[model samples]
Target chain A: MRELEERIKNDGQVLGEDVLKVDNFLNHQVDPQLMYHMGEEFHRLFQDKKITKILTVESSGIAPAVMAGLIFQVPVVFARKHKSLTLKNDLYTAKVYSFTKKVSNEISISKKFLSSDDHVLIIDDFLANGQAVQGLMEIIDAADATLEGVGIVIEKTFQKGRQLLDENGVEVQSLARIKAFENGQVVFVDEDQD
Target chain B: MRELEERIKNDGQVLGEDVLKVDNFLNHQVDPQLMYHMGEEFHRLFQDKKITKILTVESSGIAPAVMAGLIFQVPVVFARKHKSLTLKNDLYTAKVYSFTKKVSNEISISKKFLSSDDHVLIIDDFLANGQAVQGLMEIIDAADATLEGVGIVIEKTFQKGRQLLDENGVEVQSLARIKAFENGQVVFVDEDQD
Candidate 1:
């Protein structure tokens, strides 16, 4: 987590007020070494949760989820953002609004993938309004699967995402928690404060 | 490669004459163990290419690309299919026609990630018509970066993907090569015959 925070300070670009662009190393262009370390940390955090599958949404979240899946030795299932021709008809679907993109898209997972016997851990790159995670949780709930916990690479604590997940009784863990973006600079939550 | 071929034969679904769905293990619901092995095989094939970075498109390609990035000890850069709020304005863009989706999308990569000094290895889930890989090659060309080669998990020989890359003098390596799909059964190209 310290490494991630330091990397964010070194390379992360903050545009305007709410957008923290970590495309240099976190999302678009990824540091696989750092990704492996994040996976190890997540595995250490949730090793005892009996997680049978790791779930995430398409695009940015796939890197971390796949890395975590490798470390956890579990199957990784990603919900598609669009209804592709390859995707099956029988799916568990949910609608998610992206505050960053200012759009809502339907995310879905094949019904054959998730079942009541599976335990799911949702992973993602950034957690802002918590819409994406909530959508993923809905799929898990629809499948009657057990929600083990959520692992986030970077979280914006100033937003209501944490509170929303907390209200839903979903256990959440994030490597880097941003307190605020002061003057286009990141202010991380101090360890002692937590 | 043999292991990959076996897995495809066992789990892959032939939906018609064109679509061969391997989403069960390669895309939607992924087997991390198998993914790691595929990465290892790719590493073995491109070990001497001096690849400085691994490049691919978003969504399904991220899983194998990230896995190979881990083994190769390099950064992985994925082209964003859509222009998002997080993506920067300074980008190398290309238009690609998706044979699957029947739509043309602009894929872009931030100019900051790739450079002339970098040697890139492009990886993808499936190579049908090679449009996606061609789009990625355009980005690499725009940056004046060196493309070492392209690694594909599955290549449909019945299609013109291999011939397209070959005509461009681009080196390609595929784990499994499908000769044809007859009566919902996949027939792989005999390597010894080649």
Candidate 2:
């Protein structure tokens, strides 16, 4: 977590007050070594949860989710996103509203992949608006699967996402918690307070 | 490679003549251990190329590319796809036509990630039409980067993709090569012939 926090400070780009672009290492251009370490940390945090599957949204989430799946030795399912409103029958689907993009995208997972017997862990690159995580949770619920916990690579604490998860009593762990962005610099929440 | 071929024979679904749906393990629902092994095989194949970076298209290609990045101890850059025709100055972009979808999507990579000094190895989930690989190669050419080779998880030998790459004289290594789909059964090109 410390390494991730440091990497954010060193390489991450701050856009205005609320945006932190980690395209350099976390999203667009990925450092797989860092992803591996984050996966190890997630395993150490949720080793006893009996997680049967790892779920995430596609593209950015695949790197860390797959790495965590490797450590957890469980299958990783990435929900496919579609701009179209056309629906399918054999899939569990949910609508996620992205505040940045100002559009609602439909995310879906095949019904064959998840079931009531599975315990699922949700993983993603960033937890800002919590829309993506909430969507995955809905898919899991539709499958009658148990939600074990949520693992995040980077979290924006100043946003309402963490607060919403806390209100819902969902167990959440993030490798790096960004308190805020001030004058083109990142302010991290102290691990002691976290 | 043998294990990968076996997995395809066991789990891959042949939909119609050319479509091989591998969502059970390769794309939608990923087996990370299998991905790790695929990464190892890629490293074994391209170890002598002196690859400084790994490249792939987003969504489906992220898994194998990131895994190969981990094993190769290099960075992986996934080209972002856009449905719109918007262009940016700081990115190297290419237009890719998806025959199945009947749409032309634009893929772009940040200029900062690739350079003339970089030796790139392109990895992807499937190489059926080779449009995505050709797009990445175009981006690499735009950046003046040297493409060492390509690593494909599955290749369709009956498709024109293999012929195009062969004509271009690009070194390509595929873990599993499908010769044809006979009555919904996958027929792999013999390893000796490959």
Candidate 3:
């Protein structure tokens, strides 16, 4: 977590108050060494949760989720953003609004992949408004699966996402928590607080 | 490669004549163990290429690309399918047609990630018509970066994708090569032929 916090400080770009662009190392262009370390940290945090599967949405979340799956030695399932020909008809579906893209898209997972017997851990890159994480949780709930916990790479604590997930009783762990972004600078939450 | 071919034969689904779905292990619901093995195989194949970065498009391609980056101990850069607020304006863009969705989308990579000094290895899930790979190659060309080669998980030999890349003198390596799909049964190209 300290390494991630430092990487954010060194390489992250804050473009306005709400958008923190980590394309240099976190999202677009990724540092796989740092990524696997984050995965190891996630595995260390949730090793005893009996997680059978790791779940995440498409695009950015796939890297860390798959890496975590490698460490946890579980299958990783990613919900697709669009309905593709390869995706089956019987699916657990939920609608998620992307604040960055300003669009609401339907995210779905095949019913054959998830079941009531599975314990799921949801992972993602950035948790801003919590829309994507909430959507994944809905899919997990629809599958009648157990929601073990959520692992986030970077979280914006100033946003209401943490409160929303807390209200839903979802245990969340994030490597880097941004307390605030002021004057093109990022303020991180105290290490002890996390 | 033998394990990958076996996985396709066992878990892959043949839909009609064109689509071969490996969502059970390759894309949607992934086997991390198998996925990382593929990454190791890729590293073995392209180890001498001096690849500085691994590149792919978003959504499905992120997993394998990131996995390869882990083994290669280099950075992985994925082109965004849509222009989002987090993506910068300075980008190398290319148009690609998707046969699955029957639509063309502009894929863009931030100019900051790639440079002429970098040697890139393109990694992806499927190489059907080679449109996405071509789009990525175009981005690499725009940046004046050196494209070392391409690593594909599955390549439909019946399609013209291989020929297209061949005509362009692009080196390609695919783990599973499908010869045909006859009567909902998948037939793979002889391993010796590859």
Give the number of the best model, judged by DockQ. Answer: 2
Worst 10 residues of 1 chain A by lDDT: A80-89
Residue A155, candidate 3: Cα error in Å is 1.4
Of candidate 3 chain A, the 10-residue stretch with the lowest lDDT total is A82-91
Question: What TM-score would chain A of each candidate receive against the reference chain A?
Answer: 0.94, 0.97, 0.94
Determine which window of 10 residues in candidate 3 chain B has minimal summed lDDT: B82-91
Write the residue-wise lDDT of candidate 2 on A1-194 in tens digits: 88998899899999977989999997899999999999999999999899999999988999999999999999999999998556588899999999988999999999999999999999999999899999998998899999999999999998889999889899999998888887899988894474
- Report the lDDT tens digits of candidate 3 across residue range A72-150: 9999999899633455569888889878888888899889999999999999998889999999998888889999999
B32-61 per-residue lDDT for model 3 (tens digits): 899899899999999889999999988788
- How far residue B65's Cα lies from its native spot in candidate 1, in Å, is 0.5
TM-score of 2: 0.97
Worst 10 residues of 2 chain A by lDDT: A82-91
Error of 1 at B43 (Å): 1.0
Q: What is the TM-score of candidate 3?
A: 0.94
Proportion of native contacts present in model 2: 0.97
TM-score of each: 0.95, 0.97, 0.94
Error of 2 at A52 (Å): 0.4
Interface RMSD of 1: 0.8
Runs of candidate 3 with Cα error greater than 4 angstroms are: A83-89, A191-194, B83-89, B191-194
